[model samples]
Target: MVYELKTKENENSVIEFIESVESPKKREDAYRLLDLFTAVTSYPAKMWGPSIIGFGSYHYKYASGHEGDAPLTGFSPRKAKISLYLSMEEGTYKRLAANFGKHTRGKACIYVNKVADIDVEVLKEMIKQSVNFSKKMGQS
Candidate 1:
């Protein structure tokens, strides 16, 4: 049996989704992040599934034959922490992780308790690199 990807583009309003965040501080950070990502990626924010606010896009396929198109970079302001989605190969993520301020990680996603706890500049760099990497992967 084949399983489908759970996350995909949706028609939900990005602003509304941010507004729905229960934490006022998180909501504000979401807006700030939306602006920053939009400027950096030059791609409008789009709702991915029900939670993630994504920018740009690229297609990816793994050796196991799983393949799909996903946002080049994105974030989701969850109840406990904000989830940053990025792709940093060649130990780039490790380098960033060293100076990323207070954060936790799981493979591809970085979790921060709040935007203020992390360096916004570093976050921007991560997003930029991820976009470039995703574009190259798409072309190759």
Candidate 2:
């Protein structure tokens, strides 16, 4: 089943979750992630799922018989890591990741532990690329 978007409800939970993290470092990291996502997308950030703070959204379907709507790009601040979504397309962001510093990749998401652990400038470029990529997807 497709997950329903619960922007407001998720935002509240994210606020509470961030507040409950106990570690000031983690809380601050969450805030920074929030700031970066908000600044880059220019789309107001909203929480997705229990931990994900998402920005602009789009819908997609795959040949493998899967389809869904997802944030065009976003991230989650987990207890142990931060997750960034870049959406999906062939070769769109492959080169950018090389300079992104320490990170792990899933199908369309990048995971990081802390902002300081990566090259912020490169991260910004990746965010720009992802947002632009999403916009293009919307048009096509």
Candidate 3:
């Protein structure tokens, strides 16, 4: 059976979603991230699912036969922290994470409490690398 993707694009406005973030500080950081992602990726911000603000796009097919399209990079301002969705080789992620400041990490996500909690320059470098990787992967 084919699986459905929950993170497909929606018609909701990105600005509207960012504005809805409860914390004033988080809201401000959301806007900052939106601008930074757009500028770095050179792609318009688009709403992914109900919360994530995404830039660019890439298609991936995993070994398990799961295939889907996703933003090259994105972020969601949640109640506890900001979740950054980016793609980097494992070694690169580790190196960057060392300089990324106070943040948590999963296999592919970086979590920060606020923009001030991390190094924006490292974040920008990650974004640039993610976008370049996506392009090299043949994303349109």
Candidate 4:
């Protein structure tokens, strides 16, 4: 059997999408994140699916044989919070999460209500590490 991922990269304008964010603050933050992600990864922002603003992409396959391409790092400014998609070694994630400031986590995402609530330096470090890890993944 084959599986397809719904969130493939598209030609949508990232600025337009960010403009659509309902909250003024969220929209502002989205733009800030766009710049931050681009600066950190040195990659142009692309729209993934309808909402997420993504940077460079990487391909991955799980043990179950499900494989797909995904942005190396990305974020979605949702109504409740911004969801950050990043990669980290377990030990590094644990060490960084402590000093990561106020935020919640999921299996593969970090949720922050606003960027100001967390440490931007920590965010930058995580993004840098994730991009590095993803580049390595593409080589393997």
Clashing pairs in 1: none
TM-score of each: 0.93, 0.78, 0.92, 0.95
Question: Can you give the lDDT of residue 108 in candidate 4?
Answer: 82
Q: Scored by Cα lDDT, where does model 2 land? A: 0.73
Q: What is the C-alpha lDDT profile of model 3 across 1-140, one tens digit per residue?
A: 66889998777999999889899999999999988898888889999999988887888877786788888889999999999998777788888888989998877688999999889999999998877776666443
Spell out the clash pairs found in candidate 2. none
Best by TM-score: 4
Could you give me the TM-score of model 1 versus the true structure? 0.93
Candidate 3 residue spans exceeding 4 A from truth? 137-140
C-alpha lDDT of all candidate models, in order: 0.89, 0.73, 0.87, 0.90
Ranking by lDDT: 4, 1, 3, 2
Clash count, one per candidate: 0, 0, 0, 0
The candidate with the higher TM-score, 2 or 3, is 3
TM-score of 4: 0.95
Find the 10 residues in a row with the least total lDDT in model 2: 3-12
Model 1 stretches astray by more than 4 angstroms = none
